[model samples]
Target: MDTRRLYSFIKIVDAGSITRAADILHIAQPALSQQLSALEAQFGQQLLIRSKRGVAPTEAGRALYRHAQLILRQVDLAHAAVEVSGRAPAGSVSVGLAPYSMGAALALPLLRSVRERYPDILLHINENFGGVISEAIMTGRMDMAFIYGAGPLRGVQFEPVRSEDLYLIGAPTDGGEAGEVALEELAEVPLLLPSRIHTIRQVVDSAFQQAALRPNVVGEVESALTLVNAVDADLGATVLPWSAARAILDVRALTVRRIAHPVIRVQLSLVTSDSQPLSEPALAVHDLFLELVTAFDKE
Candidate 1:
């Protein structure tokens, strides 16, 4: 099979539309459609089901896609292996980071290290909530992600990086460094939390529920900055992992006290799908990520 035709087919699948793939490939739409027809003819199978929203792969297309990804990744790897003469790895790698799990404190240092050590490698980092990142990893949109270990683990493999103890954080005027607060004590504070389904929110809710205490939540927000700023403005106190609050708290000068009477720790993990092959660049970044997370993990 022609690798070029295979690449075009893969692009079509990736874009989910011939027009989008044509635009990306800088080819006319008719020309792109011809390429797809040729591939289907060669395979003697219908590969895609088209619809108004987009296209989805038939079973044959899915099989081809899986194999095509591996084939393309291998081709890139071989090209890099020869181009650098084994001096350094070179290729594009996309990694996913859960909103705060792989925050700025981890990102800045990570970018710096990858640049210094693997100058030839191209790194693409994506930040999204855990669920999105998890799906991305499984579908090969992302090679890996940092996810809440306690969340659903159906499609990916998770390695526990470390656990972070949750804390009660608020503005200095509201409660500045008052020392550890009991788990039940948080039930009394007006809380700004993520929606209930968010990993951190679920963990916090379960902890409170197990203790037969209910949090007095008043508002919901997803952005770390917004949540921290709400606390900074004294809208309400919030419970979060120390690392999640660290950089934001420093900038806003918010106060964080450890949660006690029962120290609840959320298991933070590195996630990857076994079905996807890891390229050299991805592996390098994965190793560096593990090292960096360990160094920065206070717990």
Candidate 2:
């Protein structure tokens, strides 16, 4: 039997459903089912039982699962050893980045450093939203990702890199005046925000709720770039991360201010799968992120 088939079975058992397991493995359900069937044939007994709720392992399946877990863990250790001892830290590593993150600013420097230091290591970067990037990490598509926001998520470990101050960005105040604006006073101005699901959006909304104010929203955009563009056009104003705001701030045209009652800040964090420690290349990337963020803090 293919070792990979056993791995697939273990994944299904751990996930409790073929569909969920397939998603985690980044494979199709049909292919995953075939792998399980092949594994059962090798063992000469049925391995999985399916019912209304989902899938469960049979007696034979449970026996194989116990062995499979041990074998997979060993295989992982072997791979890790080989990678660490390999020529020039060689191996491909994939990382996902939240769309608006300093990933471009941070990752580029890190990538250059890795390429210079470990020429054989291959690096891949994916740009996505916080939700998508987090999902990709959980599902094993990415080693880790840079994301912003709060809270704990099942199957993921978050390491906060730093917190960035949030500011209200809008067309320049009549004379470029910089000061605090009460959220209640700003409530009457048309607003542009990210979708409610975005972590930043939720934080900003929670602040509004606490103040008992409903914003006069003009639109909700998916990306920081689009939101900033909307604000630049004088369509309305929106809360923006400093990294994003600094990129678009045309000193002559855009105005930014701190909100009163509650000062808002968003935590930028690194997200990784809790199921396994990151690969060597991935660990390098994580370390590189720390260096970049630290340098930025110094500046």
Q: Which candidate number maximizes lDDT?
A: 1
Q: List pairs with backbone clashes in candidate 2.
A: none
Report the C-alpha lDDT of model 2 over 1-299, residue by residue, as the tens digit. 47888788888999999999999999999999888878877789999899878899999888888667656654764686586774545676777776555664666777788788778778888877788888777656677888886549986899888887677778345432356666666677787877777777777888889888887778988765676667777888877776766655553467777776568778888888888777666677777778877897787
lDDT values for all models: 0.79, 0.75
Looking at candidate 1, the ten consecutive residues that score lowest on lDDT are 170-179
lDDT value for model 1? 0.79
Model 1 compared with the native: what TM-score? 0.82
What's the CA error at residue 113 for candidate 1, in Å?
Answer: 1.8
| lDDT (C-alpha) at residue 87 in model 2 | 50
lDDT of candidate 1 over 1-299, digit per residue (tens): 77887899889898999889999999999988888888899899999999998888999999998778767766766787677666677777787777655454587788899999999888888778888888777666688787776545776888777788888787233343367887766777899888866788888888889999998999998887887678777899877787777755663466678887788888888888766667778888999999888787544
What is the model-wide C-alpha lDDT for candidate 2? 0.75
